[model samples]
Target: MKNIIINFSVMIALLASCSPATEKKVDKKADSTEVKVNAIPAPSPENNTVLKSYIPVDLSTLVPIDVLNTKSTDVYEKYGIEFSGNCYSCDLASLSITKDTMIWTNVCDENDTFKIDDFSYSTEGSKTIVKTSERTYIITQIDKAPIYELVVEGKKLELNNKRVSRYFTTKKALSLFKEHDCGDFEG
Candidate 1:
């Protein structure tokens, strides 16, 4: 019995030692804050570097000011929702939705402005529709993101909540639209 126990212990020790070792290679680059692990490098925890990337803002985090209905006002609170690509035929539109007003601006006539009223909200199939005299917007949820589709003058442009920069006032939104290039809208 003693011999059998000794043999089993020896086998267990041998098996434990025979396991493959994980290769941990840490490469530190000069003049850089990030450390390289294997080939994919990530921000080091020690440096506390913030990774700059585009993250979609949640609509539930909006101030929740009830301008129209709960559904319409929800969409209205999002700031700086714009089309993601280049459209040469039509001016790129950036929209900022406030508690009381909806501000829409394009590349051309950055100085000029117009106020849209006569707002109406409805639902068609899976889409929630908001319309003004100037344009029509269809709101729908695709995956986890709410998609805002603007239909104006027979041209359709899609804006997503992913580009929303911050929950800002109407003045800040208007200033950003006027100061920045049409394609250069950050929010």
Candidate 2:
């Protein structure tokens, strides 16, 4: 009989020590918000189907930017875009140059136009200078790669342009040149 009582007491104690996973309490005051969570949120769907690559290109695959940017030359290149969560049509960019005229096109739209015909360009060290009637385009390249910067009237233009084509070198510098003015990735 004593053993049964002791066991009963122990059982009661063990039950008391356990805690409920969730508890409910009512707020006496009106307009009170109480939120209690017990489990993690369900997984959401994946949005971006695109993936990115960081591996550098083979040097043997690259051509000089001066050659690609030359007026008599026609250049076309594509860039594997970095998958930065959300991706629009601008995920990939295409650039083409014909007779001192450059056009930037993506999967979504027609193209953006840039005129080198109105401007005379000179290669100085790591920079390309295009002289326009109203603006002087100072294009600085990075690491001999095709990544270029077009600073016109002394302003850094944003060309969400893809990486350089030298890495591929045409697409990048050209895209950078395209975006140097305005318009979003899709724009």
Best by lDDT: 2
Spell out the clash pairs found in candidate 1. Answer: none
| Residue range with the least summed lDDT across 10 consecutive positions in model 2 | 46-55
lDDT of 1 by residue, 1-187 (tens): 9999999999998877665322122222321334233324333432232221111232112210111232433343332322332123233334544323444444333443333455655544444455666556554433222333333433343332222221222232232322222365544
RMSD of 2: 19.7
For residues 69-123, could you state the per-residue lDDT of candidate 2 as single tens digits?
Answer: 3343223322223333114434333344333543334423445323235544455
TM-score of 1: 0.28
Deviating ranges (above 4 Å) for candidate 1: 1-90, 98-100, 107-112, 123-126, 133-135, 152-187
lDDT of 2 at 76: 32
Top candidate on TM-score is 2
- lDDT for every model? 0.36, 0.38
Per-candidate TM vs. native?
0.28, 0.32
